[model samples]
Target chain A: MRFPLFLSALFLLLLPLTAGAQTKSINQFYRKYKHSEEVFNITVPGWLIKLGAGIAKSQAETPEERAAFQMVKKFKKLKFMVMEDHNLVTPRDYNRLISGVQSESFEELLSVRSDGARINFYIRDKQETIKNMLILVHEADSFIMVSAKTKLKLEEIADLVNQALDGDLDNEEIVPVIKPQA
Target chain B: MKTFKILLALLFVAVGFTAQAQDDAISKYFNKYLDDDRFTVVYISPKMFQLFDKMDLNLDDEEAEAIMSVVKDMRSLRILVSEETPKQFFDEAKKAFNTNSYEVLMTVRDKGGDNVEFFIKDDGGTVINELLLLVGGEDEFVLMSFVGNIDLNNISKLTEAFEGDGDDANDD
Candidate 1:
């Protein structure tokens, strides 16, 4: 009788601790859809990210290259998923997925609708700084979601994008996989 | 020994506070919408810039050297853009600047939907530590923060380096 009471007490003691460590909503979503036929999921932890940044940093010689390499150091993990094939996933279904995604703790940072495609950016912040960010894009035939956990400040990322749009990467066409907006 | 331990604990607490204090207003905004899809986010780290510096662009000596000088000193650059009404964002940005917290470097109303504004964080001297670039209009909203060792004279030269490209930009 005493042993049974002790066991119950131990279980009660650990309950709140486990509850406090709730799994992120995005991670839960990934687990739910990971085995689905149309979903392609990729998860990379910090070690590989640091290794890649190190290799690129070794080759860095210009100001831009060095800046980019430095920024990569903040990333802790990269998670990506693409659910494609229109026959497999309809636009309405994609919208539902997006709604489900928004229902999580992530707050919308930006939303773009162009050419019948919608892209949304969301982030989870703590103490006025972002710890993780998610990007969701829905095209006619596919949906793409990318999540990054990093310590980088928002302005740093913005500067890099500005530089890119300034046409340094213009020689190569980096078009979206989605069809052009109608 | 107990006193020393307490002092060490205090030091750690202070360090933690300092780290948290470093998050600026723009960084807070960046964190707020970091994952939002409507925004195109770009980040260029110092290491990436260094990598580019190593490349052999094969330009003539003067041009190559000028480009190198500009690229070598930049610490970090980041830009965020969104295709939406940014009046609210603009107001927030202005508030974050804390009214006269930074020196107004320049402002220009460019043709079309482009209006460019520049602000600088200077420590009571010619040396500028940070440059804030804000562009706003109907088509897009942009915020660019560049932090590094900046020389105003060098910035003028940097503009000259891109003079040839200006025509190309205008054509677009």
Candidate 2:
């Protein structure tokens, strides 16, 4: 009986440590993807994609409309809309993706837990420079940020993002992602 | 036969004159406020108006005229964009996008007049993303996009509604 009781006590003690350690692990994992080479067209949540696709289809029929319709079709087919719950996106990140980098594609896999969420925000910059990027956030006990850049090669872009995420930011509070001033 | 032809020509001329008059009235109000450099808070001239007309963002006759007028009155706007190619701007947006998606930057759209927008290309380019403006009374005067399905005809009607019934809009 004492053995079982002692085991239960130990398990409770270890649980908090695991939770704390998991948060750090998530940050580390996201940092790896930040430096990743492939452009990620991060879109998840089917509702948003459906709305975007409906609008795209309407414009595609208009001859005067620019290539915007075709671009939406391409995004619809990509992995931008895969949600895994842990990956939470921030508004600032969304603005960055649309207004900032002009890239071929962007995607994110969302994963969420009680602590926060994690997103594998990815982009594919097929051009000469790494042009596409996704800003990602994991908000829970702390807010984790992922600044992503993409290249032709997914592996190469992922590496670059990983290097960027390697900076030693003290995980104290949620820092507001500072977007480029308009 | 010659009399009939002359009468038809006169009717056509009358129509043309009436159309011109209507256009002139709206323009008169637009010009009145645009040059004030108070409501819009800027100082603009007719020369700059020609270039702003080319940007794809649709504006009705009144919205365009009103925006031009407001631009003329703005006091707190200056162009901060680097004159560069599309490629360079894309690259800059990308770097900023990766870090913060809504990174605000200015793009030089025309040689004269400040033509800028708040944009982010995130939706895989599905929709033309933009919030075109400067910081002043005239800042939100022009919405630099038509993607929201905003109708120019409706905009004109709305403009007249807000600014008071333009004679043409008042018609049955």
Candidate 3:
């Protein structure tokens, strides 16, 4: 009787932890296709990202470069997956993947479809800080998914976009500066 | 134990019904075309708007301030657009939404057979809850819904801000 009682107590204790660690649907989708020959996947750790950010900050010569450095520093991890073959992901599967992502507490930030290409941005946030961001780009012949884990405040991103729109930050100038050095 | 199980089952049923009822009409219309490849959908949640309200944007410019004031009260924005069979889609959208609850704010028809209409939902006061915009032309259809406590005065100020920026650009 005491053993049964202890087992019940143990189950109660571990239940919440297991639930908390449950894999998100987006991650599950990534794992399913990441190893396929048609898919290209890359995962960068937080430490490497920080190291690169520090290096870029040191080399920053322009205001655009400085702004890019500040934005890049907020990212903790990044996962990129791309597939060029249209035969790999069926339309039904794509729809299911989208539904699954939405069910996982991810909210749509923006979506655009034009000239046979569709781009979607989704973010998961807690209060005023964004926790995770996912970008999905689907074209006639290719699909790309980019996921980032960050603790960025929402205002920072808005301010950056505002600056970019106001012609204060030139995106072309920022791109080369943030590129990782060999 | 049997009675407890019955009660749990009933509770689940009640919760399911409540969830179904809570889905708004605009969401239902959006979901209808979500899986269709021809349509593009955009959604911004209330949480995002709440976050925007919390943001301390240090812009001292009047234009930026005006835009921020209008943005802070917005709860959600949903947009659906399609280029395939746009006229048909536009007509279907008109039929799908019950317009009796909304007041027609503006309607513009250009010489090119393009139609643009604006509708607002309010509680007989200056505060608006939802603003719906529909555009249908020969090649494109667009339906946009902005939901929140919207002030017409603030929106007019935003337009003025845009006009001011345009004038500045022209001067430069």
Candidate 4:
């Protein structure tokens, strides 16, 4: 009877810790999934794309400014790229992602790595808001993408993405709104 | 014998006229190349003469003699030039060279590859065209242009564009 009570107390104490470690549910909209080698993919949703576009337009003051703003309007942008062990993830790894995303136009952004040997990526969408952040693992047959933005809309999710990827939301150069061509 | 002396004096006058004509052509060359943006100038070594086309120079006696012979033998060529710029390569050349103004004599078009302008100094006489804008001073030349077609730009990686390990500049 005493042992069972102890076990129940321990389970109750650990539950909140586990919940705190995992991302919030609305984080599905700006997914941050990790691969074992420290390389991971992160994404933002379609709705936030429009909102970012509006903000970019409001900030511009001149023809050059407007031209710069127009240049980056395309698919979903890669948020941040980090690598584990500070090693670069090879181009071969991107094949798995490009095949799955099914977006026709894509461009690679920065590739960074963390102290723990994890790699990161910031890829932009050419045709679609990223549905997934594909994480490539060492296993030959296994791969996965964590849902970045859980279920949040633009206003709610933009903050979350900025916080999650350590992204520079204010940096129009880094995270431009990807819009369809008129 | 008196007639011979008169003939000799006339011949001397004719020689002076010929020299003056060459100088006029040189002045013309300078005007055509200067103040034009479509063309850029580069300073090259004599060793690079074989590497580029349509080079211009106010050659010394030996070089001019050799070139004259070569051109005469070739029959279809006058002189080989890569490209050229104004002779007043510096801002002060207009005043320093005693040429208050410039008059054009010859113009060499880009032939559709490298946009270069050629000019010669009127003061020096137009026996040759000097790349004016590329020269730091009267006799010195340097490469200061970063043209669009050269694959170099004002991007963040300035130093790498000149020489870097990963630099992708084509070296012939």
Best by TM-score: 3
True contacts kept of 1: 0.00
- Return the TM-score for candidate 3, rounded to 2 decimals: 0.75
Candidate 2: list runs displaced more than 4 Å: A1-60, A70-182, B1-60, B68-161, B164-172
For each candidate, what is the lDDT?
A: 0.67, 0.37, 0.79, 0.36
Pull out the clashing pairs in model 3: none
Candidate 1 chain A: minimum summed lDDT over ten consecutive residues — where?
A163-172
Per-prediction TM-score = 0.44, 0.21, 0.75, 0.20
Q: What's the candidate order when arranged by decreasing DockQ?
A: 3, 1, 2, 4
Residues B24-43 of candidate 1 have per-residue lDDT tens digits of 65567666655566666665
Instruction: DockQ each candidate and list the results.
Output: 0.03, 0.01, 0.33, 0.01
What would the per-residue lDDT of candidate 1 be over residues A1-182, giving only the tens digit for each residue?
99999999999999755533333566666777778877888998988999999889889886567678878977888888897774244555555655655555455555555445667776655444457677878777777878888776656665554454444445346644768899
| Candidate 1: stretches off by over 4 Å | A1-83, A86-182, B1-23, B53-65, B99-101, B110-114, B123-127, B164-172
Docking class of 1: incorrect
What are the per-residue Cα lDDT tens digits for candidate 4 across A6-47? Answer: 999999999755543333322332233344455555555545
lDDT of 2 at B62: 49
Worst 10 residues of 4 chain B by lDDT: B145-154
Per-residue accuracy of model 3 over A1-182 as CA lDDT, tens digit each = 99999999999999855543333777877888889998999999988998999899889886566677888889998999998876366667667777877776677777766556778887877667777788988888999989898888877777776665555333435533466789
How many Å off is the CA of A86 in candidate 2?
4.6
